[model samples]
Target: MTRTDIASRTIAAPVARVWAALVDPVALTVWLPPEGMSGRFDRYDASPGGSYRLVLTYADASAAPGKTTADSDVVEARFVDVVPGDRVVQAVDFVSDDPAQAGTMTMTWQVTAVEPGTRVVFRADDVPPGISAADHADGMNSSLAQLAAYLEA
Candidate 1:
């Protein structure tokens, strides 16, 4: 099966700034999640052959005892190509206790310096089955909006 998904957003910032926000651990964690959520990059090596992980935590307004409304992750990612201020490609595999999600995915990001600012195109390949493409699209759009807000801040 061939799984391909692409999403794009234009930010009011230069290509270099957008690129930095994407690869920089501090900047990424600051804008990764939605406004209320918090995130952190456990280990990030923004170079080819280097691996990293990101952990995102969401708050649950209503959680009873013994119930959890948060999710944490350690996605193993390695930079495959890094073109400073232009593009980046990374291979990421979800690390979970469940055997079902053990698969590799490639995420490619291309930044074009447009008139207003920068246009970023994100393409994710080899998405696992059972995951809805629509959901991913929506999430990417939401994330892009949040990223724009972060960059403007």
Candidate 2:
């Protein structure tokens, strides 16, 4: 069976600002990684059919092995759809030799204008078996919090 995970947050920012944080490489570098990790993008293009690569490193060397390797996770992603201020969809795959981690995952980020701000919803479909749903949700929530802090600053 395919696994899916969803996370949502309401941020005190306009849809345009939230969308910018979602697509901008610099902003992503600041907020995309979860707690205890940092992210660097090798390439990022926020257009349909555009591809990007990113590496996430754990602050603690003793952290568990990532989907791709020990202490780090590498992702190759292609933009499947991009709608400014509304949504972005991407197909993602991890650079892993482990069969459990070798599959295409679809991630959708949907933004909607709320009374006081914007609501961002994240949906991850076809999650690999190697990823625990609770952990993924925690990471997603952490990233959203980071985005909110960055935008509200």
Candidate 3:
């Protein structure tokens, strides 16, 4: 059975701005990671079929363990679809020895214009069994809040 999680938030920003946050590598690095974590993009190509590598490091070294090596989680991802100002779909795989976390998971981000702002929806499909749904939802919500803050600044 495939596990899925979805989270949505209304940001006080335009759709274009939200889309920029999704596609721009620098913007993504600034707002993508959850609280207490930092992200760095090794490579980023926004077009369909383009791939990227990102490393996420925890603020506390002790927090790493089974999730990743030492203090960082490395993710290799490819863009499956990109619809400007609308949606983005990507496939992601974590670099880990644990078999439960070894498969490709698809994530989709949808942006819609709403009154006075934009609504952003984050959906993850075929999530690894090793990941907790509550934690994933919280992280996604945190990321969304960070995105809103980034755009507001």
Best by TM-score: 2
- Which residue runs of candidate 3 sit more than 4 Å off their true CA positions? 64-66
Q: Give candidate 2's error at residue 137 in angstroms.
A: 0.9
Indicate which candidate wins on lDDT. 2
Model 2, 75-136: lDDT tens digits are: 99999999998999999999999888889999999999997999999999999998888889
| 1 versus 3: better TM-score goes to | 3
Per-residue C-alpha lDDT of model 1 across residues 60-115, encoded as one tens digit per residue: 53331111123544567899999998888999876665544557889898999998
A best-first ranking of the candidates according to their lDDT comes to 2, 3, 1
How far residue 13's Cα lies from its native spot in candidate 3, in Å, is 0.7
Q: Judged by lDDT against the true structure, how good is candidate 1?
A: 0.75
Q: Regarding lDDT, does 2 or 3 come out ahead?
A: 2
lDDT of all predictions, in order shown? 0.75, 0.92, 0.91
Collision count for each candidate, in order: 0, 0, 0
Ten contiguous residues minimizing lDDT sum, candidate 1: 61-70
> Between candidates 1 and 3, which one is better according to lDDT?
3
Residue pairs clashing in model 3 are none
Instruction: Indicate the worst ten consecutive residues by lDDT in candidate 2.
Output: 61-70
Error of 2 at 28 (Å): 0.2
